[model samples]
Target: MAKRKGKGPTPKAEDRHWHGKRQKARAAKNAKRTGTPTMGPSGRPTATDSPRPSGRPAGARRAAGDSPELVTGRNPVVEALRAGVPGTALYVMSGTDERIRESIQMAADRRIPLLETGKNELDRLTDGAVHQGIALQVRPYRYAHPDDLLKGTAPLIVALDGITDPRNLGAIVRSAAAFGATGVVVPERRAAGVTAGAWKTSAGTLASVPVAQATNLTRQLKAYQQAGCFVAGLDARGSTPVADLEVASGPFVLVVGSEGKGLGRLVADTCDMLVTIPMPGKAESLNAGVAAGIALYEISRLRS
Candidate 1:
């Protein structure tokens, strides 16, 4: 074979790749130098990357470790502390609350770090997420077993067959707390985890209710049923109407499925009875949160 010396000039495809990268770099540099915004790959200037005045005044972004960010207000931060969020840090506005006096005392006793800041400073740190004037910097949420939550009283458990929306989960938690439900059960996978958005959407109700995540939802339902709880699945096609269902004044569980697709067949089969909410309007179905709220409130009313 004839000897081929060194490789020739780079192929056109290779040249184009390097050229594209160089062009991107040059564009970014020009934008930085001229103080002109550059379009992103989607042909839009990134709102976050664009230079803008700090939302807070000077000294607002306090140096890290100067103090943990303040969690303020009455219910949220106090409930967070009471719920045993690990490593909670608290800051209260001086003389802002007399209602939280007991909560403040508890914080002092627990040796949770405490400081006082202006309401504006508290507002800056919380980004307006209902600090209730008390803010806590703590670890993420911790979930427990549904039965564990029901240890003392007959549990009113909300079992989600396939709820994947963080907002819906939050809303359900809020409703569960309002209706005095003991816990919320969700599947381990194909579902939304307890994230900040869910916590926030719960409007601080997450602190009030225990949440359980199950590896097998059907098996968990069976466990609840065996534990003397009535397992009811919410299905539009169910033979029973939620209003008409003869609910015993005992421990019960209600299951709500995912949006778009209804309950998984296995989960539906696990329920002792499937209940439906009657809708006479043009809408064929309800949002997961709304449906969950109705069922929870009805159960609460019946139990009471």
Candidate 2:
């Protein structure tokens, strides 16, 4: 233990290009163990080269943001593995087909790991954007309160004041989980979380909704209008019309704004109704997740 004097030599042009790449990798592994036909280094002929397997495996050199990528698509990786979304990893790209290989074998029957890689290494792990070639790394989207959506069952909620993208907050949480709306409210300082191109444009609806982030969205829309609910506010200077808003009768709350400023005056005075979405053509507004899915399908056809 007393001779530790290492870090001392090899720098003359990296020791003559590391001894000419260690003698051309020992003459291409002795001409690939001797039928004598080697060439490569792009001079071609290593039997039309496409071999590649001499290195990478210390976690494949890991670094694209050191993981937590999730570049989404293919039904948001089968709805983020049927919305359990815990510990995910799923990468997929190399020749993906059979419905993205049955959504990566339903994210490997739920143990989640997947991996694959190729489409230019998943476009260099999602930096080139459009990860429609499917990409996922996982862990981040969590939010769920307002008393766990008031013990859920059809609560109807939406908020989103300063809607900062993330693919329009994963397509307004896949149109508030396809019309019945149970939870979603943003603005933890002008938002945009649940990434992976907003879960590939929320084809998985950010893994079965429940967003809640507010720090005081006009006092949680006046505490969802003192609990009896009904808070509407999608204003194109609305005077009611989201096909006559009511949103699934019972408990409601829909306030959409900030696509270049739409409803913010203490969140449109804690709305009790402002409604809009009647666009008689010549589009002026609609795309805050299609005006929050036409104001949550007019609050689910005024609660059936």
Candidate 3:
């Protein structure tokens, strides 16, 4: 069958409004979700219609000072909650296993906002890291000044020099708490801060043991020296054996260096005395955490 065209030539295909009415609806929804104004002063399109990669609200991408720390994984979340880590919200993936039930209960008991999200959304929030179906948004850790750590009549303090591993820091914090040490001092830069991993590794002792940050560790050690605290640097090669150290029972600052590199030159030179842990085994050295733990235990024993 032949049909005659009525208009001039065939009506050209016009560009359709791809966004159309749906785009406006989506923009309004997003504006409400993000707490943004839906329209501009002149009634222009002010709201964002584009979808976020992680499906999170636009308000989530706030300033660094306002952004929440994301602590993922079931065990970490549970431990952070148990340790009373300040939290803003607890997110659980829909259909998550029973492993996270305790975390849920803890969050509920603490009155933390509990949110259920899809697996993909959860993955986006954790930056594709293995979250194990749960994540906790916690506040940043507040660090004390080096002098503040020494204010109390604490006989022992542990200072970390270039120890970049958060787990090691956490272990050291835990060891210090167990040994009745006053606090831990870490460098303000080029060092591990009290992060979520550290919090988890501390096994809930972070709350009790204060962590202080020093702008200059060498200077801080010197200050400690002036305050009548002996500065003992832990190195493989030292003139004094940790066990036979005469100052073990006195107020002391035990400085532990990084595993790869020992203490910095200035830090090494600032020590009142260098001490070595006597190793009878064939192994060259112990892990930084293990070494710190051993030194702390010895100091505690001698003090006791």
Clashes of each: 11, 7, 0
Using all chains and alpha carbons, the TM-scores for the candidates as numbered come to 0.57, 0.28, 0.74
Select the stronger candidate by lDDT from 2 and 3.
Answer: 3
Which scores greater on TM-score, model 2 or model 3?
3
**Model 2 TM-score on a 0 to 1 scale:** 0.28
lDDT of 3 by residue, 1-304 (tens): 9999676664433434554677778887777576455554777433132122231232122113324567777776777778776676777875356658988888889898787777877766666767887878766678887877775464688999999888899999999999999899999888888776687778879989999999888989999999989899999868788877767677789999987787888999999888989988998888899999998888888888
- Minimum summed lDDT over a 10-residue window in model 3 is located at 55-64
lDDT of 1 by residue, 1-304 (tens): 8987998787885467688888879988887556476666987554333322222222111112223333345765566456454435556666447646756777888896665656776665665545565555554456787667565456788889778777799899999999988889898778876654466678778877888988899998899888888888899868888776556357888899875787999988889998988888999889999999998878877787
True-vs-predicted CA distance for residue 155, candidate 3, Å: 3.0
Model 2 over residues 159-238: C-alpha lDDT tens digits?
A: 88878777788888888888868778786775675655566667766667778777778987887778777787888898
Q: Give the true-structure RMSD of model 2.
A: 16.9
**Worst lDDT 10-window in candidate 1:** 57-66
Error of 2 at 294 (Å): 7.0
103, model 3: CA deviation in Å? 2.0
Better of 1 and 3 by TM-score: 3
- Identify the leading candidate in terms of lDDT: 3
Q: Native-vs-model 3 lDDT?
A: 0.78
* Residue 262 C-alpha lDDT in model 1: 75
